[model samples]
Target chain A: DVKVTQSSRYLVKRTGEKVFLECVQDMDHENMFWYRQDPGLGLRLIYFSYDVKMKEKGDIPEGYSVSREKKERFSLILESASTNQTSMYLCASSSVPSYNSPLHFGNGTRLTVT
Target chain B: QKEVEQDPGPLSVPEGAIVSLNCTYSNSAFQYFMWYRQYSRKGPELLMYTYSSGNKEDGRFTAQVDKSSKYISLFIRDSQPSDSATYLCASFTSGTYKYIFGTGTRLKVLA
Candidate 1:
């Protein structure tokens, strides 16, 4: 049923503030991602958008920055938030398969950059 | 090093046991292999989706891909407690669309 929605699920922000994480995918999928899941350092890939205004910079895009004007929305910008940018923040969407087609997540956003 | 090598396991099984999860890769141009199931803060739930190598079941999960021993496996039969959580192992590298995980393995299927 492909449904990825995330606007917030517990965020607190403080140090340097300015964090906006939002992702919406109703299956218009063209490829959209932004991940940051720490703990032995795992899901690192901080920006990806392959359409509407395209953008790319995975592998920990420092300080983070992304926004895909449209196409089911995908935004993740932290510009300043510190505290190591807190943790848990995922948003994925993929379609245009040819193999590696396994990414349809959302339901995360546990930022707490105090 | 660290193209994908998972062993963050908290591994602890009981209920019906028989759960083996692993991952190892140095990137032999990873064909495409996946296994995700995270449920502790949520955001990963696409268990098993293979390509290029071998097995792929979906009743109790079973995904094994061995590109000449690049190694990868995920088997969970009978295990319950909702099968605990965290078990990621992903790969994808050809023209690069990005899909490389594996730093997760925290299963605890007690009962």
Candidate 2:
């Protein structure tokens, strides 16, 4: 079974603090994604990386950035956390761009910014 | 209009009752439709996947797609308490890794 592991299950940070969410997948997938799930807004993509050192901005990338330093690991960074940035962050991995390949997701990291 | 639209329903049903979930999309380029189920404090898990249009069944779950209407449906027969969760509908354009997801419908199957 493929496993996507999130480093932290719960986190609390103060405003203006920097936050880091780590994700590691054992599936050896080439594509990794960071998404923020909000109530009534669904899962909005924050950023994605198709290869190491390569990243693309998604719809809601303003308050977030990502890094893929090595295969099997992806990281989401919040430069300055704010109250509005409080939400559940999810990490997912996929093999490639194909109809048959679906994303394998991590359990998620719930971040609360005060 | 949003690319994908789903009623953010907290639909409640008794155990053994039939449950229906639906989603509509405005993008005609979307050829692949998928349903994901997310439990409390957990990430969304892919449940059913359909390409183009038609019906597919797995156990007590049935997925239906209608390209002409740009609509999709998921039906759960004899719903159980364990079926309570948030159901998300997503659409993918061919050749793209990005997927647009719906707001999700929250279902509670009471015992």
Among the numbered candidates, top TM-score falls to 2
Off by over 4 Å in 2: none
**What are the per-residue Cα lDDT tens digits for candidate 1 across B30-73?**
88888889888888988778887889898988899989989999
Over A6-50, each residue of candidate 2 has an lDDT whose tens digit, in order, gives 999999999999999999999889899999998877899999999
- DockQ computed for model 2 against the true two-chain complex using alpha carbons: 0.78
Report the alpha-carbon TM-score of model 1 versus the true structure. 0.34
Cα deviation at B98, candidate 1, in Å, is: 1.2
Against the reference, the lDDT scores of all candidates come to 0.88, 0.92
Report the error of model 2 at residue A94, Å.
Answer: 1.4
Question: Per-residue CA lDDT of candidate 2, range B1-111, in tens?
Answer: 999999998999999999999999999999888999999999998899889999999999999999999999999999999999999999988777788999999999999
Q: DockQ of each model against the real complex?
A: 0.33, 0.78
